[model samples]
Target: MTTKMVFAQPQPVLDARESDEWTSGICDCCDNKPQCCFAFWCCPCFACVKTRKYGQCLCLPLLDIFGPAHPATLAMRVSMRHRYGIKGTICKDCAIATFCTACAWCQMAREMDSRAIPIALVGTRPTQ
Candidate 1:
């Protein structure tokens, strides 16, 4: 007798167009006054908090001063965009990271908090 093994395929959790939703814009920080104040007054701490929430080291954002590239900020933005399948270009991400780092970070934090369900935890599953 011969035996065979089979593996189940995963399903798509969201609809095709679901990923097209726009994220919170960078200047929308005032939508949440407390969070806005935190980000504005303590940008480094806020950035560190946001980085840690993404499962990275809390102090990782401090690396931004090492260069104009703002590697840590870029990584967070890229990861967030990929996780949510958000429609955006790398040029935009780089520009935001390079010119408006604080606003970018604040927007990311708001996006993550505003989502009813965290994108990262929305695994592949059947859509009702």
Candidate 2:
């Protein structure tokens, strides 16, 4: 059985998500600074169980559009849909707006460039 890493202090000493040394080695969110946390499987960030406001990541569009959803992300979707009713389902366009990734809506997670913070410009969906 896989046991989750529970931190007593709820704060990581060194934030890997904020580290900028490695493009993929460190956490993706650790661009400004080191993202110290007590987890690494799904992701390492300050928005984990300790963040108090973290109910779930709930962006199903990202999972569906991006493919190969992580367990944490899936959990967030379930919570967002069933518990909080954030959104039943979101499209790629919505996720891009929600995640501010309109310019970098990558098809693959590994293809996401940590440094490439696309200009957060608003997008208008193409007419059908």
**Alpha-carbon deviation at 30 in model 1, angstroms:** 0.8
Model 1's C-alpha root-mean-square deviation from the true structure amounts to 6.4
lDDT of 2 by residue, 21-110 (tens): 223321243332322222222232322432223323434333434544343444443343343222334453245334533111221132
Best candidate according to lDDT: 1
lDDT of 1 by residue, 1-128 (tens): 55554477655474333655456778988888888888888888999998888778999999997887898898899888887778889899999999998888888998777554534554554444
lDDT of 1 at 54: 74
**Candidate 2: regions farther than 4 A off:** 1-43, 49-52, 55-68, 90-128
* Candidate 2 root-mean-square deviation in Å: 21.2
Give each model's whole-structure lDDT: 0.81, 0.33
Q: Ten residues in a row with the worst lDDT in model 1?
A: 118-127
